[model samples]
Target chain A: MNLMLPDSGLLFWMTIIFAVVFFILAKFGFPVITGMVEKRTKRIDDAIGAAREAETRLRSLAQDQERIIAEAQAEHGRILKEAAEEREKMIVAAQEQARAEAGKILEEAREKIQEEKEAALRDIRREVAVLSVAIAEKVVRKELSTAEGQKEMVDRIFDELS
Target chain B: MRKMLVIFIALLTFMAHPVFASGSSEGEVDVAEMIFGHIGDSYGWHITEWNGHHVTIPLPCIVHSSTGWHVFMSSKIEHGHEYEGLFLAEDGRYADKIVEIGPDGSQVRPFDISITKNVASLMFGSALLLIIVLSCARWYRKHDALEKAPGGFAGLMEMMIMMVHDDLIKDSVGPDHRKYAPYLLTAFFFIFLNNLLGIVPFFPGGANLTGNIAVTMVLALFTFFAVNLFANKHYWKEIFWPDGPIFLKCPIPILQVIEILGMFTKPFSLMVRLFANIMAGHAMILGLVSVIFVAARIGPVIGGSMTLITMVFGVFMDCLELLVAFIQAYVFTMLSAVFIGLSRQGGHEEATHDN
Candidate 1:
């Protein structure tokens, strides 16, 4: 038997069958498999991108929180400083008012003392004048009783007049 | 076990008759013929022998000739019988083929289009491949979105298909490989399935489909068409007039002729390489088995020991052939991809240079 020779019948069958198989596989089989693989790859990539975006957003939010806390702390420091300054101003004004009130009280007290000393000196001068008048009246009554003594007193008075 | 031993004794007695009848000058069973017969294609499927009876499944014999179409079962031509001017020729130039007796009693060869042994096996292998591949495709379609990873038969088939696409086609054919992926995948799986089937020494498997030259030729032809059909203008330019100095072209243009011949030789080697490897593997197995029968001619003692030894060696060779089956299929597909890839390199040179 010639083993190498090709049989016409078998060749015809082989060609037809192989062609049918090739077309069927090319049309139906390959596209589905490749499509699934591509889809899976795309899904994984999208998931990774979303995760990275979320991470960045979280980081930014944390930064915003830190900034807000720092601003609040600075505002608190300013309010405390303003309160300290206001307290110092009130204390200084109260001290100045007290000093002015003490000075006015001292002046009033000195003026009253001087008035009291002048009144005391006037009363003493009145008492001395009354005492001298009473003494002179008593002495005149004694000299009239003695005529001779009275005549001598009249002559002395006339000479003083001239 | 008793039945096997009865059959063995029957075969010995049957074979001994010829030696006794022929005066014991030489061995009765022709080893070369036996080997060739086992390797050759036939018009019937040989099942087994039962009580000196040859049990076979006869196929249909269809022929077209100058007269008209002649269709009949192959059994009509059995046992040297002739029917409707057709018979299996046993002598001369057209021996072992169905021929018609002309009006002058001379032999005339008709166009034989019979479904021979190899044809039946091819059909069987094709059916098997279709079942496996189509089922995998359907399963992938149903659970494609839900199932992240392939499972079961679908998983196995996907791994192999991806290997062909990524490792074989993409590596060789490059970026435009998607267009050619289907054809390459089909060719690889088809050849691989047939090779595996040919190793099974039973029904639906024993016929040497890949070992047949016509089958391998057809496979190679597909690759040839794919390579040339999609080839761009630059491919032809490189082949007919390669880029070289003018002085090199002046010396008889030998390079151009060789380049042109290389195109045909590429596919030719693909065809012959697969055919020869598979055919030789089968022949080697058959030759190993023949050692037992040959040893029997000396005596039963030697023959029994030879049978044991041959069985051990035969099993080893069978394992080797299994490996060879996969390797040959891989080699055929790989070379086809490389050749097609080479053809695709035509228009990409400038694009690559720009990059």
Candidate 2:
């Protein structure tokens, strides 16, 4: 058989069947599968990008929390220091004022005690003057009756007063 | 068990074929004619013959003679019989073809377009490819390709599809490959499927469709058009006035002549390569099997050695033919891709400058 020369009939049918196959496949088969694969890749990429953004936000939030707590702790320490300093200053001022008040009261009490002692000395001196005058009257009457006895009494009283 | 049994019977037929062919007519076996007859296209699908009873599925025969049109089943002209003066020409220019007696008593061929064994197998192969590819495509439509991976036969088809579409065709066709993917995928699977089917020795197979020169010619023609039609200006320029030394272009245009010849020869080789490889494979297996009958003609001692030839060497050749089947299909598609890719290449000067 002459195998090299292509027959007209087989060649005709081959062309028709191959063309039909190509048309159907190009229209419905290939594009759908390839397109779906592309879409799936894109979705996966988008999902991964969103996950990365969320992780970054979470990490930043943790850092912010740490910074805020540090700041609050620093503020708390400063306030406590300030309050301690204030309390120390108040205590020192109160001690100084109490010492001054105690000194002032002591000075007033000393002054009052000097004035009461002076008044008490003046009343004792007056009572003593009155008692001496009554004794002198009685002695003068008795001495006139007896001149020698009165003279001796007056000498003894003058010696006692001296 | 049944399939093995069929094969054993077929082996018996192969042994009996020469005896039957010689005994009936010429008193000697023509081994070349016998091998060619098995591989060649026929109007009837010969299943088998047992006890002189020929069981065959007859196909329709259509022909247009110089006289008029005639259409009939091949069974109408069985066993050297004539239906409307048309019969299987036994010995003439168009031997084994549907022929009518010319006025000069010579055999004459008409314009024929019948459903031969090869054509029917072609239909079967193409239809099978359609079912497989379209079914996988439907599966892709039903489920998300990314979310749910294809399973079973669809999965197998996808793996093969990606290899052809992405790996082979894409790499070969360069960028703008998507435009060319459909033809390449179909051609690859078409050749592959037919090659596998051609190796089967039973019904629905055994029709060497790809081995037919006419069939491969049609396939090569498709690639031939795809390459030339879509090619850019630079591609044509390379073919007509190729980039070479001035001497090669001038002084009888040696390079230009070579380039032009290369274009046609590229596709021509594609057609011949597939046809010759498959045709040779079938012929080799037939030759190996026929050795047993040749030995049976001799005495028992050498007959045993000849049986050893068909047994050990024949099986080896069959296995090799199976490997050759896949390789030839792969080589055909790969070469087609390369040729088409070469035709679509841009200017090398521009390419070098960009780099």
Among the numbered candidates, top lDDT falls to 2
Model 2, B22: alpha-carbon shift in Å? Answer: 10
- Per-residue CA lDDT of model 1 for B184-207, tens digit only, reads 888888889998777776566767
Q: What is the C-alpha lDDT of each candidate?
A: 0.79, 0.81
Instruction: Place model 2 in a CAPRI quality band.
Output: medium
Give every collision pair in model 2: none
DockQ for every model comes to 0.37, 0.52
Q: lDDT, candidate 2, residue B284?
A: 85
Local distance difference test, candidate 2: 0.81
Candidate 2, position A38, lDDT: 57
RMSD of 2: 5.4
RMSD of each candidate relative to the true structure? 8.0, 5.4
Model 1: per-residue Cα lDDT over A60-96, one tens digit each: 9999999999999999999999999998998898899
In model 1, how large is the Cα lDDT of residue B336?
Answer: 85
